[model samples]
Each structure stands twice: as structure tokens, then as C-alpha cells.
Target chain A: MTAFLRRRSLLQGLAGGAFVLVAPRALADLGSRLDAALAERFGERRPEQGGVELELSRLVENGNSVAVTVRASPDEPTPAALHLFMPRNPEPWGTSFQVAPPALAEFSTRIRLAGTQDVMAVAEWADGRLGATAVSVMVTLGACADDLYLEF
Target chain B: MRRALLLLWLLLALPGHAEPRAGQISGYHLLGEELQALQDDDFANPGMLWVDRGQRAWDAAAGASGTSCRDCHGGPERMQGLATQLPRWNSDQERLENLEGLIRNCRSARQQAEPPAYESDEMLALTTVIAHQSRGLPLAVAVDGPAADAFAAGRDAFARRRGQLDLSCADCHDRHAGARLRGETISAGMINGFPLYRLTWEGMGSRQRMIRWCNEAVRAEPLQPDTAKALALELFLAWRSRGLELESPAIRR
Candidate 1:
């Protein structure tokens, strides 16, 4: 009975430890971890997609470089920080911008998409509410990892 | 005296300036809203990827001296405003040297390192790091003094029409900067972003690469990136960007 109890305790500890280890990583990688990452950046409150206008082209000849713009509606409350995300990129979050009032609530930047994928941006307002939106981009040629072996 | 200077400036631009006292437009304004947003976003900006690589190269040691860039340059923050004054006159060599030329010189002379190819990854990485230092600093270049002759040469080149299309740099950039060409807005050829991350390349490339692409776009035989003519044109662009802020590691489509 004691042996069985010891083995059960050991398995319980291992399972708990696995949850601790895997949980953060599961939040780290992008596939769907965006919600978790957003929670970490903003808060636990989920954001509804609206109030934010994320703009870009529907198709790009090359995936290497593409332009994106994120803007809050003129009437919408200004956001505190703006962050962009690429769901399928090697790294999902591209970057963030801090908005200081009473400045224009508009922001723009350029980003690379891994492939034909959707790009998103979230604007966290001063009150902690978030306005989110996503744009679809099609890249013909994705970013290249320079083959240094061939060059050298 | 100010009026006299203005008259001279007017005369200088008259050959191609289409309008009197034509103001210059920075590349930032010429971009569509989508592009501007991408530039402002730090995380998704593909250019930052190059900047990160550059940060690594700066820390790594190279050359026969076994020294890294940090050993001599101190820190990147110290380099702020450095690029604003580049493509200047090097009186010691009596030549005009752009950022890349000076980079090659530094590698060969200071580090005793084999200089990188004109637009190699190492070269682009290092250049991007250096340029990132000058981010947000206003463009500033001395077109007079020892740089005068080169600036004049650059100005001459800007006005000289070439290529199979019979177009000069001035024809598009200076005269019709805001005009749309086949749906693309034309921008003044500003060199504020020397080592920019371009979408077409999907990686970092030097200002020389961008210039060469424009040269080819006009069906002109592009000058070598390291060539004297190219440096002279670079000087003109630097002078052109006098008041604009530097957005090195800038993103472009």
C-alpha cells in the first residue's frame, strides 16, 4: 500500500511539473498563443475585433517586405500601446508602439509575413480595453534565410 | 544675404525644380497609410530583424586584430547623429565616402579585417547597427567646405538625364515627387535610411542597392555601389534630406 502511494505521489508531482513547464511555452509560440500573449501585454480581458483599423494590401508580389497601418477611429478612445502580430511567423509579435495623448491615434509600419496569412494588431486603451483587427496578406516569395554556406 | 542665398538655391534647382521654392517631401509622407503603420510598429517591422542581427555582429569579434566593433566604438548610443553627417568629404583621402565606403575603410584599416562585399549580410548588418544609432535624428550634411566639390558633382549627376527612358533622378524625385507612377507614389530620393530593410529583398540591403534598383528602373546602366559616381549621388541625397529625420533600418516597399 505504501509503495503504491509513493508511486502515485511521484506521478502526481511529475504531472504538475509538466504543467508548469509546458504552460508558459504553450503561451510563447504563436499559433494560438496570441490570446495569451495579448493577455500578458494588456490583460486577461478578451478583445473584440473592431474600433481598430488595420490596413494592408490583399496581395504582394514578394513576402520580403510589406507595409501595414493601424489606426483608431477618430471617435474611439485612444490606445495606450499598439502591438502587431503575425500568427505564423517564426516569432509572432513584430513590435509595439506607445501612444501618448493628445497625439494622433494613428500609427504605421512595415512588416514581413511568412506566407499567405492574416496579420493582426491590438490597441490597448488607457482604460485597459482593447480594440483589435486583422488584415490578410499574400506573399509570393517569403523571407529567405541567406545560405551563407553557398556565399562563403 | 539670405535673399541672395535663396536666389542661388533657386537657380541651382531651376533646371529641374518645376515650381518656385518647391518644398521637399520625405519618403515617410509619400508612403501609404499601411506602410507608415508598419514602420512605426517595432515588433513586426522586418527591418528590426536586421537590426537585431546587426546588434549581434557588433558584439562579435572579427579581423586579424581579433577585435569587435564595441572595442573601439564604445556603444551604439554614442553613434547617435553620426549617420546624419555621412557621405561627407574625407580631406585626408581627398575623396567623398559614403557610409559603406567608410565602413570598408574601417574594416580594412582599423580592424585589419577583410572588408565585406558591397552589400553582403555582414556589411548590411554592421551598417544597420550604425544607422539604428541615428534613428530619429534630423538629417544634417555639410554640402560646403571640402564637401562642396563632391556635392556639386552629385548635383550635376542629379540633373543629368540618362537611361533608355531619358529620365534623370531629378525628373521623377524632384519634379514629380508627389505624383503617382503606375499607382506608386514618387518620393524625393532621400538617403536618410541608408541601411534599410526592403520588402522586395525581404532582408536588409544597403542604400547603394536601393539606388541601383532605381537606376535599373530607369533602364540606365547602374553604377557600382562603391563607385565615385554613386557616392556623389549619395551626397546629393543626403543634402536633400537636410531637415528630415533619419529612419535608418527603415522599411520600404
Candidate 2:
């Protein structure tokens, strides 16, 4: 009887441990995660729309790898850094990069989108002004969701 | 004279004697405009990441011998035009060996290390890096002598229809190459851009992985990777893709 009780307690303990490890990531809403990422990067700064251009195919056939380019208006001052966000992805923070001299305020990269959603890019200027733009992408296939291997 | 002409026409119409495709369509041209652009840009193409990884691994020492690939093969430039001639007859093993099989054998026998699995990151990187060197070369696998039997087997497999869909590779890739299926263009099933980064995969994959994926898509019995059947099919593909420029480590959707 004592051994059975001990085993039950151990099983409960393992389940609790597993929950603790997975809950934080699984439970957090994707939008909140994006907001959290933004807050972490730029505290107390609200970014204004425009002054930055985000270029990508509006209609995506496959959401695994999408080419994206974020460029600050050449007429405007070059931004200090660029931040990308994908709210529909598991992690909303796509990637961040610093913009330095000799290099323009434009950056191009390939990113994964979880589904159809608005992908945004924020550019932080030297004078603390934040400029942003978002593109609504219609993803035809969420290819990444399919597992690489499946049992016959 | 009439009998002789009929016999010649019949012989030409036979499956085994069917001439190779006179005009080949490259898989790259079949991609959507955006995907083509993505593949064009060095920075935007995700396959470059695997190439970068492979470049690093080229010089890194491994195994009991502590020898890098560079020690024997020299720089990756030495591998130029090599990918175009793969799935060749390996006399030492007394069997055909594809790029992945050759790499596996090299690592196991030469490096004295455990071989990387077919679709593993390490193997993909190595294959991508090596194949990237031969980019723009034409496919030219030998189809006679020791390779004849395998070529025949592969051609048979390509035409044989088995699966819930009852579709053969020729039914789609050969008969209707330019037609659209579910918003995606059906390519000629050319393999010049193998060891590529597929948007569907969200990562780099080998040609064997692509074959297995197609089999699953048609609800057919899965073809085990790196097997004799798989190697035969690869040799056949190489022959079919003859004259198509290599776009190894290409971006595909």
C-alpha cells in the first residue's frame, strides 16, 4: 500500500514538472508575446506608422520561408536599428539588427510565418522617433505545420 | 519496305526504347515570381544558410584521423562540376552511390566516424556546400554499361503506377508538366536543384526526402532512404535532367 502511494506521488510530481516547463510558452497568446517583445526592445516608445517601407509578397504560397525587406524612407534620417514582428508565429519577434554607417537603413532577410497575418517592421531613428509599417500577407499554405516525418 | 517501316515505328514506341526528352524544362522556371526572386538573391535565399554551414564544416577536423574534407579533396572549388555527374557506379562498393551515399561512405570509411543520416543537418550542409560548387553545370550521369540495369529499373519505376491515387511519376511530371495543381505549378520533376531549401520543409532537405514526401502524398508505400531502389531512381533522375543547369541549394516552394 505504501509503495503504491509513493508511485502515485512520483507520477503527479513528473506531470507537474512537465507542465511547468511547457505552460509558459504554450499558454501565452501570440499577440501578447509580440507586445512583450516590443516592450522589451523599446520601453515606453510608441511607434508611428509610415516613414518605413516593408516589402514582401502579399500572397504567399508557402509560409515556411518568406523574403522580407524593411527600408527607412531615403528622405528621412537613417534608423539606428530595425525590428521585425510576426504576430501569428509561435515567437512574434522575428529578428532584430543594428544599422550602422556606410550601410543604409534597409535590411533584407527570409522569415517563417505561421499563418496569414500582418507582419510589421519598426525602425528606431537616432532621435528616438520610431517608425513602423505592416503588410497583410495571405498565406495559402502553412507548410511548416506539416511534420517532416510521418508513420505509414 | 512497309513491313520494315512498321517494325521500326513499333520499336521506337516501346517503353524501353522511348527517346529521352528532347526539350527539358528547368524546375526553377516553374516557381512563382516571388520564389524565383527569392532564389535569385544570395541573402534572401535560405539555402545559402546551409551552404554557409557547409563551408565551415569543410575545414573542421573530425573523427579518429582528425582529418578535414579539405585534407584530401582540397578546397570546395575542386568539387566543381562534380554534382552534375553523381549517382554513379561505385566500383569499390559494387553498387551505385548517390551524393548522399558517397558522403556517408567517406565519413564512415575515410574519416573513421559515424556517418550522418540522409536528411540530417550535417549531411545536408556537406552536400549543399559541395553541390553549390557545381551550380550552373549541366546534369550528365552515365546511362550505359554498369549503370544500364539501374537505369532500366528506374525508368520502370517512373512509369509504374501504385498508390491510392493510381498515379505514376510520368502521369504528372511527364504528361502534364506545365499544368497547375492546387495553385502550384507542376514542374517536369527535374532534380538539378536537389539538396535544396524547400519552403514546404521550412529547412534544407535531400532529394531522397523529396521522393519520400511525394510517395506519401500519393498514399504509396514509402520508399526507404538510401536504398537500392532510391539510388536507382536518382540515377534515372540525373539522366532525365541532362542539360538542365545545376541550381543546387536552390530555394523551392
Candidate 3:
């Protein structure tokens, strides 16, 4: 009877330990997805926080598409390319724009939103280093209905 | 002879009596040859593959009853000019009927086929043919009476803000006309050119497609492509572009 009681206590301890171990890892996984996407695109060099701006609303009713604007730092030379990423989307990389030197310092466009997700924008400078920034948005209504074609 | 003289004198004295100028209409802007060329190149000339697809769909048999659009309307030519005046009051139904609504009605009443969704290519094609027939005619959407109420509803929809960004249609199109957004210059929010060939879309698309794209841009749940609200907005836009020449196949960046 003592052995069975000890076994039950051990099982309870294991379950408690498993919960503690797994919860943080799941969150880290989500963060790492964004980090990995940035790492792959921007490489080992970490981008500076200033000069690049990402404008988005705090609340989104639909998660299908969202408007985004990226502005390069005026102090630095105009960025040659701007890359956008949505961490939670099925495809994180939304689009990349190549800006001519004479062009304006800002680029704006629309992007697909997967859900309440973190969006990142990285600017690739002429010298090859990248700059990045991120924002979090809340989504209420999900886009892309399952039975879209069923209306017919 | 005295009565005839009196009638002539009265006709001459009528208020502002003068012969109406030939081609004189309110809000008419004549384009020079060069501008006309540019306008045509930009908007008028393009292949309408979707319209062709719609023509086929109209004739193709479908549904349990196996009927086609041809079974009722005869064919494409006979159905011309039908779309130009649509979204009109349907006395039979006692409601307004846009092109898509009419198509849906026809599908149920005659073709026995399931009606395509509001913004489906099938509906667009049928609408294209109908609008194409009135290519040169001035757009004449009734804005008074019950239709006026629809126009007011549409305007409200256009101005309402929702989504994450909380932007309205007026914010970009009305406020920022002639301004550059990204790489492209914004065009006036005109519906004269629809079923247009946008470089971005890379194919023929309707004004409703553009509206959906805008809704998506703002991170709003886009309404069904052919929603009544969208139709109402189209009616409002059509009224707004009343005097502009219809440029169905215009190109855009």
C-alpha cells in the first residue's frame, strides 16, 4: 500500500513538472518563429531600432488583410529593399520592395493578416546590413470563411 | 392672320428662347486628341476574357432542370444594353434590382441553375455584357425616391470606419486624390472604368473587386463580393460618375 501511494505521488509530481516545462517552450516557439524569419532574411547582423517605422492599428476586426506602411530613416541613405513579415501567418514573408535611390523614404501597401499576430519589417541598406521593427495587433473577426464557395 | 402673328410674337418672347447647342450637356469635358489617345490606351482597349467566360456560362446548361441563359434571353446580343439601366426599380418584385440580383432571379426563374455569388466571375461576365451594351450611353442611376435611399445607404457604407486600421473609403480616395501612396498615384474614386485591367490584378476586374481589395487592405472582414451593400455603393459611385465617359477596360497601376 505504501508503494502504491508513493507511485501516485510520483505521477502527480511528473504531471506538475510537465506543465511547467511545456508552457514556456510553446511561447518561445512562437517568438522563435519571428526571430527565425528575421534571421533568415536579415542574417546575423541585428538591425537598429530607429529610422524604420511600421504603422498599423491596434485592433483589427478581420485578419485577412491589413494595411502597412514602412518609413526609412531620413538620416541614413535610402534603403534598397524593405521586407515585411507576419509571424503567425501561414506564410510569414508578405512582400519585398526595392526602392530606387531617388524615391521617397516611405513605402505603403496592404498585407494578409493570419490572426492576432506580430508583424515585423526589416530594411536592407545599401551596405548590406538590415534594420527591423515589430508591432502587435489584435484581431476580432477572422477572415477567409471556410465555406466561401458554398454561396453559389 | 392676327392669331398667327400673335403666336409668332409669343414664341419669340418665350423665356430665354434660343436654339440648344449641339453637344452641350452639363459637366461635359472635351478631351484633346492626345488626351483621348492616352485615355483610350489607359482604359478603353483591353480583352475581356471574363466577359467571354460569362457568355459561355450563360449558354452552358446546368441545374437539375438543365436549362441555360440562352433558353430565356435568346443570346448575348439580345441581352445588350440590359445592364446599363439596371439596379432599377423592378415593378414585378417591388424592389431595386442590380445586375447580380437580376441574374440570380433569372437563374431561379428560367435557367433552373443555382445563381452565382455576387462577385463571382459568372455574375461579373453577365454584368459586363450588360454594361458593355451601354458603353457610349451616359450613366443614369436614379438617385431620388427609393433609389435615393439606397444611395444614402451606400454613402454611409463608404464613410463608415471599421477594421484594425479604422480607415474609411473617403480617407484614401476622397482625401488623398492625386497623392502618391507607395509607388502609384491615386486615381479619383471613379467607377467609369470598371471590368478594368489593373496591372496589380493582372486581369479584368470589377469595381467591387477593388472595393474588396480596399477592405482587405484595412484588415477589415471583407463583405461577400456581391453583397447588397456593395451593390448599393456601386450605385452611388455610378451616380457620382454620371457625366464621365464609361471606360470599362481601363488599365491601372
Candidate 4:
């Protein structure tokens, strides 16, 4: 009876240790899944770093959809296209806007957030390089986790 | 005979000119003291505390230059009537500038300081004081000339549909104005009273913030606070209610 009790205690301790080690790996795996989804959609087109401005709140009260704006930097010629992506969202590639040249480098729209995550935008310049900016938003309320929909 | 017929036609037009909606247009009148009491209550109201904090920040100095708003505008009282004609076309910048932008510009150019964040308390306070100055004046936002393109763009944005819920601005305010939504009567999408004190928001929020809230409430996503489309809609709403008197710090359910 004493030997059996000691074995049970040892098994419980091993199980606890395994949980602590595996939980973080699972989350990292989920994150990589999101990144993989985004990469698959974006393909070989790597987003560049200058001439685009992305504006968003550093903190979001709700993550259902946070307002986002992507504009061409004033110095750059107006961008012909702009793309937005949320790496952690179920659907990573969200929306793209086709802009007219000489258009104000300013566009505003909203996007869904899966959780507290980095939201990135890439602006395709008139010249081929894509400019980008990213902001991490602390989302207190997760995105529409439940399937409830309200109709107006 | 011709003159008599003309006289009859003129008489017919007279009755039509008489106020058709006179009976329905009742005015709420209170005595001067009563109105003053209401205004005082407004000032001391807990809702105004946000504005009060803004007032304090407006006078406080910050940034690398360490200059306060008092350095330029000489404080709130002197800066009245400033907010009424905002979002005006700035010739120097060659773009439409809002109150927040103007505050930042003032800090950058006059104070040699970095502009406060877009929604910072300092910006709100300076703007509140400016809006306070134009308190009783009618709203008169210009919608023509170079602003016409922006106005058209804004109107388009208001009409556009996107987001998971697939809703538009008109679906609520325009179509359902005055209808009760969750115990509150929806007022017309009027911009007459802005920087308003809302029991729901519990703070003074601009029309732009309200616009963003509407988007979120409908689960239709939201645009950035400084987005051009939102600004354009703001311009359009300001123009729509051009002759309405400004009612800043107003109480709303």
C-alpha cells in the first residue's frame, strides 16, 4: 500500500510538468499556423518598409474589429494598392484597396482581430517596393468568438 | 378679368406660405435664471469632469519645449469661438485640418513642442475651450470648392457597406431616427451638438468617436480615428446641419 501511494504521487508530478512544458508550445504552434496561412496568401511578395503609414490604437477595448488606417507617406508618390493582414485571424488576408495615383496616402477601414496581436499593413508603392507599419493592440474582448449575430 | 384671376392665384399661394408645421414646432422656454441654473448644473455636472480635466491639461506645460497653452491663446476664455469654424481648409498645409490637428500644429509651430497624441487630454481640452467659445453660434461648415471632392467621398463612404454584419450608416440614423433602440430614442444624425456629454459614453466625445462607436455597435468594423473617410463624413454632417446652433457639452441619453 505504501509503494502504490508513492507511485501515484510521482505520476501526478510528471503529468503537471508535461502540461507546463506543452501549453506554451501549443500556443506557439497556433501562432505559426496563422503565420503560415498569411505567408501562403502573400506568396513571394514581401512587403517593404518605407512610404506607408499604418495607424491604429495601441490598445483596443474590443477585438471584434479595430479601426485601421493605411496611408502612403507624404514623401512617396501615391500608392496604387494597399493590403491589410492579421496574422492571427482565422482568415489572415483581410482586404485590399485599389487607390488612384495622386490619391491622398490616407485610407481608413476596420479589421477583425483574433486576440491581442500585431496588425500589419503593406502599401504597394508606385515604384515596386511595399512599405509597411505594424502596431500591437491589447484586445480585452476577443473577436466574435461566439457565432451569435444580431440583425438591424 | 385677367387681373381678378391673377389676384385669386396670389391669394391661393398665401395660405400655402403660412407655417404648415406651426402646431408641431413647440419651443421649450425657460426663464433666464432657470437657463443659467441649467448651464451651471451643466458646468458642475459630473459629465463635465472630463472637460475639466481637459481644461487643466490645456494650461499645464509639457513636451520638450515645456510651453503651456497659456503661452499662445492666453487661456480658455480668450480662446472662445474657435471651435465653431474648425476643419477649415488650411492654405499653408493645403489640406483640411480638424481641431485636433490644429492643436498639434499650434504646439509644434508656436510652442516648439511635439503635438500631443490624437485623442490626448491636452488636445481635448484645448479643443473644448475653442468649441466653448463658439457655443451659441450656428454651425457653418463649408462643403464647396476644394472640399467638394472630399464631401462627395464622405457621402460615398457613409453609403458603402462592409464588415461581417454588412451595415451602412443610413441603416440606423437616417432610416430609424427617432425610433427607440434599446430604451433610447435615436436622434437624427445631427452634428449640432457635439463634444457632447453622453450618459452612455460618460465623457465628452466628438462626432468622429460617435461614428466609430456606431460602427462597432453594429459589428460592422470601424475606421481609424483620423481616417480621411471619417473626416469626410464629419465634414458632410457639419454641412448638413449648417444653420443649427452649436450645443457643446450637451446632455444626451
Candidate 5:
């Protein structure tokens, strides 16, 4: 059954015409869609990749509920808010939290992933600067609102 | 004749393959690091939500009697080591009954209230609280005397091949354990983690629901919930899990 799913995903990738050289164009489109959503929220401030740390498994067995943690480095400016995004998900915006002053810019929560996609986190500092990071998570099996049993 | 009796005694004392302890393995060790961490973290484990609900249900009074589980049985802590003996013979019902069945019986017979339907949130919550009490206790279900027939039936069910895939529960969980089945590793079909929170289900589930899912996966006709057959299978699974610590409300993929 696992082989069947792997074969099916490979076939899907091939059909998307990427020749397995890179990600399918559909995925690329979703990446841009994420960028657009991020732009709409953060507005012209391109979030950098190193200011904040996003902890997640590179490969997850089930995508239903995955534990994730985000922490802003101490050297970096204090973060005022944090936002999470998943491009391939039905909703590009995962969630957001406002960090009160004197509180640590670190938080942990569980989120659902759509499939093999990038999970991005953005942190807004008190100085109006934005820092972000994204991790590529390969969901072995996509379980976002999935049915429990398969009908033969 | 005395020598023959001595030989029978030795055979009876021998540790047979049916004893789960011989090669027993909990599903927890088979989990990936992430899931293991999740299960270990009481705050982060999603299954705790059900346990909390169960706790509430245990104290809240219901039915004509207005007696809560706590009023009679005190706290869930008092029920320690109780779950390990369940799916046992119920002389009142004159049939085998699991923890859920016992809960249902209490509700209808003692509390004078309609029992919650099988798989209902109320049922799952109540069962979780009781089973959670037995966490870390090894399964030690007795399958002798009046319970022997059900145990034999459960063993047969575990080995019986059904479904379109033509696979028995033992075929994958026993013979092919440790082998990769798709993205996941197959572990011995243990039931210690049940009433667990499964990522695939994204919610709490009873052992019967998990069994039904397995039956469906194999394309076999699932046994109806709360039936004699289902209880028999539960007995078999609990007995097969002998010596394995219970991890109720466990987090699983």
C-alpha cells in the first residue's frame, strides 16, 4: 500500500511535467501564492531567513496534527507578533499570535499541513523589522481532513 | 502414570508463543521521535483533552440516581489496575464485556439513565478516564473457565483471513512486524494505547473503532460495535498484550 502511494505521487509529479528535475509547476505556483499572501500581510518588507528559528520535522508520518515550535533569537530585536503560513493549504495563513512586551518571542503549537510543502513563520519586531524562516516538510501521508478508512 | 502427569505439568508450565511476553513490543517504541515526544508531554499530548473530559464526566452526576462515578467509586485513582482485567466475563449480562460495555451497563442499570451510544464522546471520555487510571499496569486478562470460549474466538478472529485484501491481522502485525508498510512501520497489533488519539482520525477513538478501520483497510466486513464478536476480539487483543504497560489516551500516528 505504501508503494502504491509512492508510485501514485511519482506519477503525479511526472504528469505535472517537471521531469522530476525540480518541484512541479503547480507547487511553484503555490509558493508564489504564499509570497503574495505574505506580501499582503507584511507589505514590501521581505522577511529574512535567519532571525527566527522554526522547529519541525523534515518528514512527518501523518499531517493531521504536527507539533511546531518557533523562537526568535535573543540577539535579534524583540518580536511583537508571529505569523505562520502554509502555502499549499486551503488557507495560506496558518495562525498568528501577539506577543506582549517582556514575554519571550517563543511559542509552540500544533498545525496541520496539506502535503509536502514549505511551512513558513514570520516574526515582526518592535522596531518594525520582519524576520522569517521556512522549512520544507515532506508529509508521508496527507491527512488534512482525510477520511479514516478507505473504501475498496 | 505419575511420569505422564509430570510431563503434562511441564508442558503446562512452559512459556508458549501465545504469551505476549515472549516477544512483546509496545507500539510506543515503534513510534518516531516526534510522536514519542508528543506522547510523553502531558501538556502537548492531544489525547489529554479526552482525559480531561473524562475526568469531568466522572464527577458530574447524571440519571435518576444522581450519583456520579466519583460518588460510588471515588476518584479514578481508586480504579487502578482495573482496566487490565476487563473484557472479562460479565455474569450479569452472561456475556463478555469490555470497559465501555461495563460503563454502559452502569449508566442504564444503576444510574437509571440511557447508556451513551458506542463511539459517542461521552462513552470515549468515560472509558479514557478509567483506562488512564491503569496506565503503566501490564495487561493481565484471564482467559480461563467461563472466558475460554471467547478467548479462543478472539484468537481465531485474529488469525482468520477476511476482506478483499485477503490478509489477517497477524499477517502484517505479527509476521511482517518491523517491516515498512508504506511510510509507517508495522508493529505488533497491541491494544495498550487505545482509547488513544490517532493523528489519522484527528480525534479520540475506542478500540472497536480502530478495529473497524483495520477491517475496512483490509476490505473486510467490519464487526458491528458493542457486539459479542467485537468484545471477543478486544479480549484477545488485551490478552495478547499481556505484560505490556497500558498507555491510555496515547498519541499515535
Candidate 6:
């Protein structure tokens, strides 16, 4: 399957078509998406000093679904909203969560990462100030996609 | 006859830990604090994503009937405590059937849709959702009557050493559960959290996949997923975790 893609890319090159046809959709531009997600979520709400705790494995065995735990210190007002994102995932807008005070501002879930990258978590504390933290993870192989369109 | 009976007892107990108990610890106890906390919380566990997907599929119409799983099983609340009794004895087929097998059978026989492939996304989602229905319910599969032979086979498989490593399930999970193997602690192997999400897989997988992974890890020929041998092994593990509550879609590292 790989060899076929390579040969097809060569033929496309000869046919004057650029490599864009063979490039993965996910491989296109994750940086802009990440920025967009950050901008949309934060919107000039600068993160306060240390309150959010991002728990994730330092070394991820795979990129398909890495377990992540984000918790805010139960000091005073607990976190109200928790937003999680991976800059390298197919989509940077992973998921937004609601954290109740009684729940102690904790959010946990599995998420996909496309490559080695920092997993970022931002929490909106009850004081309205935002607290954020991140952990870097190394992934071996990213998850395989069936929708990997190959230009014929 | 007395001497023969004594020898038989000795031989049966010699292979490995084979005693059936009323209950045991769920593998959740074996995980790290973070992983354990993840399992304890429903919102954060990654497996919930698959469960949501499964819920969606449950309501989506498919097959010739153009009906969703919700049409039959209704809601997960109605089907609680179902996964604990899986790998059931199918009297009609004269064989043991695991949860996945039953799901497929339903797809073919009832749904009239081509059953999804083993370990496929559709199958895993459905299995996870269904297994989640039994969450917190004690594992209680019957091993009498027609299921007795399969249970015995499972017990044998649990004891027999396999692979180039010359190890058995008992060697790591039973005898040396608290001990470290290559820096990782071995816990009593349990299956309550089957279709559980492994951090390594970053996705949900079945108990068959987990069994096959262990087999390959020890350089043993992994059995085909859902095969008779695999079903027997799964049945054994389920019985081993007899008293633990179902933790399907549990998180793992």
C-alpha cells in the first residue's frame, strides 16, 4: 500500500501535479488550528499562576488515545470549566468539560494525539481567572486513519 | 482407591493456582493512583467517548429491520448486569459464546445486518456500551452443565505454560502478582474492565485482543480472536474475577 502511494506520487510529480494531492489532511496545518482553538477559548483571559494540574503519561505508547487527568486545586472556589487540547491532534479542540465544586474540579478522559506534543489544559476558576498547565508526551506511532485519501 | 484419589488431588493442584474462589480484586486495584482515579471518574475516562459512540449507534437504524439497538434493548439501564454473565453456553450451537459472539449473533440473527468484524470500531463501541451497562455489578457467570467442560478447558489453559518465555498466566498474574516483572508489577489478571481503553492502544479493544497481546508478548502463538481456545481463556479469567464489579471501559496504562 505504501509503495503504491509512493509510485503514485512519482507519477503525479511527472504529470505536473504537486505533492499536495498526496499529503494527508491531518498533515496539512495543525498549528493554525491550535492557535484558533486557543484564541477562541481563552480570548485574552491570561492564565493565572499555578492552580491547574495536568496529569498525562510522559511517554505515550500510542497516539490513538492517551489517558489524561486535569484537576484544579480545591483551594477556595473550585474550577468551573475545564478545556483540554492537544496541539498535535487532528483537531486541537478536543473537548470542553464542566467541573462542579463538589466534584473538585477534576476531568479525565482519553484523547488522540497525532504526534509527540504538549497536552494543554486550561481551567476557568470560580474567581473568573484562568489557570493552565501542560505536559509533554512522546508518541511512538500515531493512530492509523482509514480515511487517508490517496489521489489516484 | 484412596491412594489413587490422593494422587489425583496432588496432580490437579500441582500445575498452578487453580482454586476457584467466591471473589477477587478488580484489576482497577492493580493500577496506579492516576489510572485508578481515571476509572473512578466517568467524565474523564477516555472509554466514555467510545461509549457515547456506541450509544449513538444504539439509536441509529441499520440492517434489514432498519431498527436501532435501542428498539430492542431500550436503554442501558434496562440491560444492566448483562456483561457479567457472558461467554454463555449456547445450547443451540453446543458451544460457549462470549459477549462479542453474542453481539455478532444478534446482528446476524436479529438485526439482519452483517455483523461487524471482531475488534472493529462498531463491535468495540457496542461491546463497551453493553459492558458498561453491567458496571459495578458483580461478575457471576454460570459454569455448570454445558458450560462445565469449557470452564475446565479454561482452567487448563490458565495453568499450561506457553511461549518461548516458558510462562503461564498463573506464573505472573497468580503467583507473582505483587512482584515486579521488568519494572512493572503483575496483578492478578482480571476481565471486569473488558473492552477497556488501554493508554497504549489509545483506543478500545476486546478481551480477545488483550489475551492475544499477552500471548505474543511471551513469544507464544496467539490464538485467533474469539476462537474456542480464546473463549475458553476469557471464560477462565472472568470466573477468576468472580466477585468484582464490572468495570468495562475502564482506563489502563
Per-candidate Cα lDDT values, in order, are 0.74, 0.81, 0.64, 0.63, 0.82, 0.75
Ranking by lDDT: 5, 2, 6, 1, 3, 4
Q: What TM-score, over all chains together, does every model reach?
A: 0.62, 0.74, 0.49, 0.51, 0.86, 0.63
State, as a TM-score between 0 and 1, how close model 4 is to the true structure.
0.51
Cα lDDT tens digits, model 2, B1-253, are 5345334433443444335563356667656678887788887688999999999888888888899999999998899988899989988777888888888888989999888877888999999999999998898999899989988988888888978989888877776555557667566788989888877767888888888887777778878877788888888888988988899888788
Error of 1 at B179 (Å): 1.1
Per-residue alpha-carbon lDDT of candidate 4 for residues A59-138, written as tens digits (9 for 90 to 100)? 65435445677887788777778878787777777788888855665777656677777777778766666677777777
Q: Which one is best on DockQ? A: 5
Measured by TM-score, the strongest candidate is 5
Question: Arrange candidates by TM-score, highest first: which order?
Answer: 5, 2, 6, 1, 4, 3
iRMSD (1 decimal) for each model = 8.7, 4.4, 13.2, 13.0, 5.1, 10.0
lDDT of 6 at B95: 88
lDDT of 2 at B100: 85
By the DockQ metric, which is better: model 1 or model 6?
1
Candidate 5 accuracy as TM-score: 0.86
DockQ of 6: 0.07
| Global local distance difference test of model 4 | 0.63
Tens-digit lDDT track for model 6 on B1-253?
5345334433443435446341244556655555677777788777998899888887888899887788998886676887999888999999889878988888888889999898888998888998998888999998889999999999899889999988898877666554555334455677888889876655688888878777766768887876787888888888888888888888765
Q: Tens digit of lDDT per residue, candidate 3, span B74-141?
A: 87778655555556666686566777787888888776777877666677777776566566666667
Name the regions of candidate 2 deviating beyond 4 angstroms: A1-49, A74-106, A122-132, A142-152, B1-23
Number of the top-ranking candidate, with lDDT as the measure: 5
TM-score of chain B of 5: 0.91
Candidate 2 TM-score versus the reference: 0.74
Better structure of 2 and 3 per DockQ: 2
| lDDT of each residue in A22-127, candidate 6, tens digit only | 4445444654576678888877666765677888898764466567888876663677888888887667878888866456678667678887887778888666
Among residues 3 or more apart in sequence or in different chains, the pairs in candidate 4 whose N, CA or C atoms overlap within 3 Å are: A48-A130, B80-B133, B81-B133, B81-B134
Model 3's alpha-carbon lDDT is: 0.64
lDDT value, residue A56 of candidate 3: 80
The candidate with the higher DockQ, 5 or 6, is 5
